[model samples]
Target: MLAQTNLPQVAHGAPYLSVVVPIYNEEESIPHLYTRLQEALDELAKPYEVLAIDDGSRDQSFHLLRELAQQDGRWRVVRFRRNFGQTAGFAAGFARARGEWVVTIDADLQNDPRDIRMLLAKAEEGFDVVSGWRAKRQDPFLNRRLPSQLANGLISWATGVRLHDYGCSLKVYRAAVVKQIELYGELHRFIPAIASWQGVEVAELPVNHEARKYGTSKYGIGRTTRVVLDLITVRFLLSYSTRPMQVFGAVGLLFSGLGGALLAYLAYIRLFMGSPLADRPLLLLAVLLVVLGVQLLGMGLLGELVTRVYYEGRQRPIYVVREELNIE
Candidate 1:
């Protein structure tokens, strides 16, 4: 189990909302980000904190985060052992969050912090997850925006969540909803899909998009491929995920039965019609079917074993502490 960062437990004066920001090599954006976030918080009329997770950034991000956290009691920082990607960063932030409503936004200024109120307003309308949709994005035509459109379309079809931008990082999920979602890999992109699968009321609102003013884009063509792959994962988990054995075992049995029936027919032909079983094309076909059937059966067994032994052991993760914050 990996040790999780602990924010001071909610004692008294608990915040009304939490904004989770995941930073990885976004050193250039911290100063501006902090100012914008503060401006947004001041307008909210509710006590809120900024929970920033430094995903083992190999840059000046941690220093800047510490400076910001020290400057304002409302800002808290969590540093990971290494680069754990956005999903892990999100987990760290969400684990330490103590707000009634939690908003997740990217470190890049592309997701305007000023739009937090829009999401909060949607949340007040009884939506569990209010995702931000960038109606007119300010990214390059080919590399970012086009691929995102294609991926979002495919995900909407697969998950039945009709949203214009599933890849948008600006989303407001109830703190309880955020705590319920278990994240890994690039699954952050599919938060709305997963939440909807868990019977959460999901909705989206168009938000402002800004051109990058600091660093280059973190995403590229590789991320687009990963998004497509994760879409398949989300669909699989939604439909037949709970019973792993059923899916693999049924396929295995189907192949095995086909193989057995073919061999039985070949045997009957050899006995009744005097068809020679040796050096025949039908016999070769039967052998191939049997081999394929065995492979599928083996795969099914392996899937069951892996699911029980490996995944079960990964349920608890605890991290050693360097320093504790806010919690008694």
Candidate 2:
């Protein structure tokens, strides 16, 4: 038996944990969803709910889920009007979550729901996020498994998360960490990188991986290409990454200053010794530097302008309400 406590009326009320399952085209898997979820949460000593966001599956997945939700209060389903991608589903689930901790898993059953206890155990140890590592994944190596392994390895090197399986579908995060990060595009796969970027402590634990019993794997080689591009973007956005002037302006200034100094030397030479300015390679370098410097300076100014404009337009609120949970 489960009971939900209502707090003051606000955007979010705190619960022990919220499981965000992004479902798509998993008609065959819906039958077993509630059973596995109940099994996992049974071991946990806290109240929790399953926030299953259906990404507009054209099958009986959503309809079945709605029936399941009606049967049990702990199980809730959010249906999207159209087929937004997995990231979008996860994003919507996270946005609608009302728990102190958030656990995310794929609906295809490749990830064991029972291992959520392992992740939650790690989270209890005070880490901001705990990701599952499929050390001995049961999936075949030739097609889906090898590509995922390679991508996880490359992503680890690029972002320094260093988990055996960054692409693993199962992960648990503190609610504060989940709420703080902005997830869009395919960036849901790179949650640890973003959390680390925001100074959240992240760790990984080896968990049991099961072969899928139902439904098809939604991922393909296309996801690999998207991940590569998104990795570059994530690294850049670690700071004023989108702001171009910070990098370009510094380079431009250094080069331009050198060019100006060289030109000054050329002027001295032309004035005193009557050397032809066009004859010297140093003069040409100076001219180039000056031009580069101007470009750099312009870039810096432009970046600053863009940044200011963005903040001004956003009208971001300065104050936020944070609720504490499960902490002594």
Candidate 3:
């Protein structure tokens, strides 16, 4: 479970909607983004709080965010010491969110704040997570759209949680659903897949997209490699996080069985069929396979021990950082 902090509440009691925005170097877009969010959410007529996460922005984004928060009681700001990436920014927001429904969006103004109503309506139909899909994405097809499509397909195939746009930062989740899952690394992109371990209902909706009005895109082919690598870790956590020995032991047994069969055949030929016992590469291969099998089996046993400590002991955490500035 995520640890929630004591955050200020709106005048109209607790907010039903908590919008999380991750701010990078979006100094130019912050003011307009805040205005749009305020307008759209006030029209919804529900008590809402906007959680603007300042992810070590080196520009005037943090100053603008603080100024806005001081002006609007419903707006809150959290600033990190240095840029820890978007995933960490979202994690920090999730840690402090106190609404029934939590929403995540980018601060580049590309994600339309008006689309929040659509996602919330979809969630009202008993879905735990409502992911926004950019069906008509407004980006370069070769550089952005094509790679995102491929990655979405790969992630869906690997994790069995199909969605057209995993890269879309505009997504909605029930507080119950998101608070239960701990996010670290770049696994924020796989929230639906991660939450599926508990049988949560996830929905996808087409949301309006716009070209970036300010700042360069923080994403590129560089982030694609990191997402793919993190997928491997996500797959492991979903399948073997609790009992890793099952996978490792299965592989170990296969190698050991193959090696044993080869050694047995060699022994038979040497003893009964009069085959030469020396100077054959098969002998060395068999010995190496046997040794490798033993090592793998040992690794499986060690993995089991670590899993126990990870679950039972809970000795290590996923993130730790110190900062000169920490505020909310």
Candidate 4:
């Protein structure tokens, strides 16, 4: 439910490349980021557009973006009414992107814009998605680096997409491939894994990382927990998205079998030894397990119905287009 305004029609023909950047309170870094990004895009000598989605910045970020857009038509700006998170910002950009290839980068100045050429080169080699790996990340060791390392490993292991850096924001994707994916919540962190689900060719390359010179880091330790939860979502969507009943039914059966066995043992003891079931806590535990198992099975059925509704119901898209600039 993102409210968009000032959306303009796209040009007749698509550009060679579109760079989508999500800006969040980066007023201090705007000038440098714009200069470097423009320089990098200009070097390609191809038709390109920069889609700058301002994620409800509390500072003068939007004002500066407007100024840049006015100065150069290649600079397109999209401002959110309020902060909608990074994933929403990216989705907004993707919906309006009219380019053969799309590139995404952070606005903090940490990801070098010059490495974009390398990513584009790799993408030209027939890769649907090219992810950047910050091989030598220049962030705080404990707070940023360590947690990112652990998260990357866990995500790779769970999704079977072995990339060294899942946290890196610099990435390249074919416009068609990116447009097919629906980004929501924190799902942007697992773009590679999600795209791989469609059998897209995904490749990772080492990219240069720079130290932050502007605003404080927006992420914290809490994001690690959120990433773990989102990773579970990604795993479920990858394996059982079409047939959710498989996973839920399997788990429900296991629990039901365990509970049934426990209850049968309790019944045998009660009948054979004449033990009073009312005095044993095991009876209550068994009963609780059986009830929980039944509830889980019911939930699996509900999930199957929900899945059908999602695919067969209204053809609502994952993203809402508020306004687009320089897109056909």
User: Best candidate per lDDT, number?
Assistant: 4
lDDT of 3 by residue, 96-148 (tens): 78889999999988889999999999998999999999999999999899999
Clashes of each: 7, 0, 0, 2
Model 3 quality (TM-score): 0.92
Provide the clash count, candidate 2: 0
RMSD of each candidate relative to the true structure: 5.0, 6.7, 4.8, 4.6
Please give the lDDT score at residue 301 for candidate 4: 93
TM-score of each: 0.89, 0.79, 0.92, 0.90
Model 4 scores a C-alpha lDDT of: 0.85
Where is the poorest 10-residue window by lDDT in model 4? 1-10
Which model is ahead, 1 or 3, in terms of TM-score?
Answer: 3
Q: Once model 2 is optimally superposed onto the true structure by TM-score, how far is the C-alpha of residue 275 displaced, in angstroms?
A: 10
Name the lDDT of candidate 2. Answer: 0.78
Residues 1-328, candidate 1: write the lDDT tens digits. Answer: 1122333334347789988998889889988898888788789889888888887778898888876655666787887777778888788778889999999999889999889998999899999999999999999989888888888888899999889998889999998887877777688888888877668999889999999999877778888777778788888777766666677777767777877898999889888999888878877777787777777778777777876775577555332223334432
Q: Is candidate 3 or candidate 4 better by TM-score?
A: 3
Could you tell me the lDDT of residue 129 within candidate 3? 96
Off by over 4 Å in 1: 1-12, 294-298, 301-328
Query: What is the Cα-based lDDT of residue 129 in candidate 1?
Result: 94
